[model samples]
Target: MTAAPNTTKPSGQDSPSTDTAVLRALRRIRVPQTQRNRELFLLIFAFLVNGSAIALVQLGTMGAIDAAFLFYCGALIVLVLAMHIVLRLFARDADPFVLPIATILTGLGIAMIYRIDIAVELGGWDAYSTKQLAWAAIAIVGAIAIVILLRNYRVLFRYTYIFGLAGIVLLILPIIPGLGTDANADVWVSLGFFSFQPGELAKISLAIFFAGYLVRTRESLTAVGTRFLGMTWPRARELGPLLVIWLISLGIIVLQRDLGTGLLIFGMFVAMLYVATGKTSWVIIGVVLAAAGAFLASRVLPYVGGRFSNWLDAFNPEVIDRAGGSYQLVQGIFGLAQGGLVGTGLGQGRPYITPLSQSDYILASLGEELGLIGVFAILCLYMVFTSRGIRIGLAGQDDFGKLLATGLSFTIALQVFIMVGGVTRIIPLTGLTTPFLAAGGSSLVANWLIVALLLRISDAVRSRPRVVIG
Candidate 1:
């Protein structure tokens, strides 16, 4: 009772102690400010590079700057600035390099699209470049909304099953009779004036689902069941999830007729699974499954078989001359060859001579115009972006965040590899877009969403208190 009576301090003395405690708490919780400044500076440079590319395209093509270019540039700047503001408000401690890298890639894509539009004499709203700019704006808005709404990446873990269900629904949407649109691949869903690839959104939803699912089941998955060639493998029963995913991927390839997306989705799952379990055996199993899937698809599916044929005999006279043959592949190769050491200068190249110059074969068009050096620079940008995302994943404090980041980052890397490798004849072309550098609205939206998620994760990781092991 005496000790309790002496515990109460004077109000005057208590006020100072309370204030000191408050200051200390504030110091601990205060967001890091320097990273944002570096991001801002890089963003400015990205904008300059983007603007210059547009200007150069205008000057190189039309010989003068036009009102359309100016308007698009102004709108792009405003949209990006708004995104930057939103980031500052919600993700103050996010990675500094991701946003700028995405911006530069998007801008470069638009510039290239615009250049192609001019070459094709496509003006007004009919221009692919105009559509690209609009999509870019929409993508920025989507990113902003994601940052504001999903302040914590961990909240996604609460609805893991819901995300998985949503992803399945999205994947099947493109195959629905009335809703589906038949393009080169049966992957698009049309709603009157708008057509979209649901697979893009499906990828994001699936990544979340996979991250959460693996986190909850990591112990069982990682428990060693068998040993072979100095590696411990999971039990056959433990691989039910992988088998299900692989079958779904095969279905995508066979039914939807999109080998690229099938490969992309399957590859992402394998990458995430390996990271979660830290098992090379899972990778071996995945590769074996992938090889089997590819072999089966090549034999049974005409589209998949055609891709293999194109890859193997692209320059063959009969193969190149046949309808829906290797003509596109050969043209892409020639375009790259034309580029050589240095590109033919943006507007000077005949990139439009190749089909889908602004979409599927856009990289070839870019290679033809930017040369090997420019392609190298663009590849370097992708390398940095992917590396930063992996770094964020590695630094994550939670298993879900790490897997999600890794899956998303690996998705980008895989898509880039598929596109580049296909175009270079290192693999069969899969018709996947080159991430932020492509002319597809669906791709741009999906990629920007990824950037937003990575930003949120990075902010959480940086803001969280670190544990120092003594």
Candidate 2:
């Protein structure tokens, strides 16, 4: 009788021992309906916050709630609901907080920009607020398309080098003779009717290249290195990838006059390298290399040196009064001081006194209006967004997804640091738009696309198929 016992074990969850009773096979799924529900709830609050802020802006600045503004807000809210419905069907398991946080930040920026328009007495389609709204609409459409069409982001891995080349071409486009605008920084491309910053999209392409390349070459990077300063440094041969990226970054800084973007691109790679290798030495090497490049640039380029001087002696009478002086910097600082612990209450503050309030100085303008408490809230939103993004990367089952999610998320966080550091006088100022909160068509589109990518990644991480038997 004992010979009747079989000894084969089941590879799947359906073990023979469960044959005593009826085994009901059920597939367990998580975070589709629930994630979407959470997002919908958060979206309600976001809508309320944005609507209140806009209503208050009109009351404080125009002394009446314009019927048209209410209609406009209602239309935007409807558009957002449509987006939510689309996300539910497409990226059902995406991080719930990411979209809502972006929604609030963009709304608050528009509210502030609208108030500024009143202060400057600009109106109609010419106002930056109007243009920003149009851009936001276009960006949302682009984001939706990505989320829907790019069901499997892994396809991008196949075109790694192609993305890298595209990134190079984009970086170069803004420097081409006829295409580049006549701005102080050669970072924009003009196509007759509209202008764009190619660096914005270049970020996405380059990040993909970096993630894919590192995923394949991580073993080589981590395998062989020389010991130096109590740490393992990459061998001269292993250093090729890093050196190439560094040189390209330097070229951007020196040629395009885009110090922020150059820094953004290089810093992104350094962070990704650390993620790939799990070594502190790479970070140290990155800092050293960046400092060296910066010092060299300061010597070769007068503007770079001037930026450093402004950072150091912004209050100097000679520096403040110069043609391209620190007047704006000083004015922004005074605005922050005026904001105190609590801001001057929305549109009541004179943020127009600060130059470039709607763009580069948007944070200072917000600080002057909403105060320190508001600024901290905004920063906290960024922290949440970043944490969610990093969490998605950590939860990924594939190397490429892990590196890509983490790298892109780190880029957003790095950009925040760069912008905030400049505004608070923690670093030399360079032009980098605040994500989701600055008035730029290019930036808005890029930001939404980044959000879409993160959403896609998070969904992929959570929605892997599973089978169970009991």
Query: What is the lDDT of every predicted structure here?
Result: 0.90, 0.90
The TM-score, computed over Cα atoms with residue i paired to residue i, of candidate 2 is: 0.93
Give candidate 2 regions above 4 Å deviation: 1-27, 466-470
* Residues 394-430 of candidate 2: C-alpha lDDT, one tens digit per residue: 9998989999999989999999999989999999999
Tens-place lDDT digits, model 1, residues 357-469: 89988889889988999999999999999999999999998999999999999999999999999989999988789999889999999999999999999999888553232
TM-score of 1: 0.92
Q: TM-score for every candidate vs. truth? A: 0.92, 0.93
Clashing pairs in 1: 343-371
Error of 2 at 300 (Å): 1.8
Estimate candidate 2's RMSD in Å. Answer: 4.1
Candidate 2, residue 413: how far the Cα is off, in Å: 0.7
